[model samples]
Target: MAEPRHTRLRRRTLVGSAAWAVPVLVTANAVPAVASSMKTDLAVDVVDPPYDLDHWRPKDEVPVYRGPRGHRIAARGSLPPSIRITNVGRLTAVDPSGSVEIIIRDYGNDRASSAPGRLKAGTTNPSVMWTDTTNQSGAKYKYTCRGELRPGQSIDIPLRYFVNPPFLHAEFNVLVAAWVEDQQEGDYDDNSLRIGHVPWISVF
Candidate 1:
């Protein structure tokens, strides 16, 4: 079932396509609907993971990457997972074109860079945050691509994910973050997104 908007809490009032966030929340969502306010100028999002880009990419229903054959992502975590990208800004996200940098975070590390600034817990729904993958811990990897992806445009990341392991069950927190250089995102929020995983497992 979808969650009620009233139950959803954001650091700031989201304008543009961010106004409607999916029910995907962590324990932190129970806080007040408004806080001091967090903001980001960064213009792209990982619309949804787990649903796999090739199979289902949501836009009108909700919102929810790339690569050659323009941009691609390495599947990591408890994943064979793929992420979708969307340009949610009024202006185009580009270095004169579309330049996107992505970092795949490990299951539970919630650092503000490359990882979610806020800790979220759930499955399938994508969470977005603002981060720089400068110093990340655990099994994480980074990917980037340069092209022209206009505002409101989306691209699905190709499936090429891998996970390093010791042992585990089927469930996992599949986390990822994206950003563009030269543009400063307003808050340490929403340039990154994460979701829990279903059965399919790949271990090293």
Candidate 2:
């Protein structure tokens, strides 16, 4: 026997509805896949820069001499050093306002104990304070310095301090770093530049 006309119409309607539903479900699942593909493309475009050499300017000849224990021999280079820093805030005289920090390391990768060897802000610290590098093998030194720059104010750190280097074959580099200070306790800020190498020379 033939089926009723009403039943035939119901069957047709159900089949059409399922066909449309399949496309909608497929499209819904495809959205996440499309977003994932776009994310991967964006990640590939991100690239980090290599090292810069010009930032680490080389000196002609750095002098090597000796000062008495607990005493520092200061030497001022003829030319001043220039550095560009970022991530630092205003150059006010307040906590976290922005200041300068200088560190010296000996050729043997050890901190040198030179009395009165410090960089004084707003002026020459010790006006040529020196370090005794005499008789010290591999007696090299590196200066790691950083400063916070306030708006419209720039600080120029002259290559003024010198050490009485001990070894003639000693080699060293100077790195200038800068960053904003974190107000939180125990959490330091991230450095901006790992300046190229500043070759240390002797003026014997």
**Cα lDDT, all candidates:** 0.33, 0.27
Reference-based lDDT, residue 163, model 1: 28
**How well is each residue in 76-186 modelled by candidate 1, as lDDT tens digits?**
233223445555443444422122233332323322223322121112222222122332342233444345445556555443332223223232333444333423334
In candidate 2, stretches whose alpha carbon ends up further than 4 angstroms from where it belongs are: 1-80, 83-151, 170-172, 178-190, 195-204
- The TM-score of candidate 2 is 0.29
Q: What is the RMSD of candidate 2?
A: 26.5
lDDT of 1: 0.33
List, in order, the clash count of every candidate structure. 21, 14
User: Which regions in candidate 1 have their CA more than 4 angstroms from the true location?
Assistant: 1-42, 49-80, 95-136, 164-172, 179-184, 187-190, 198-204
lDDT of model 2 at position 59 = 36
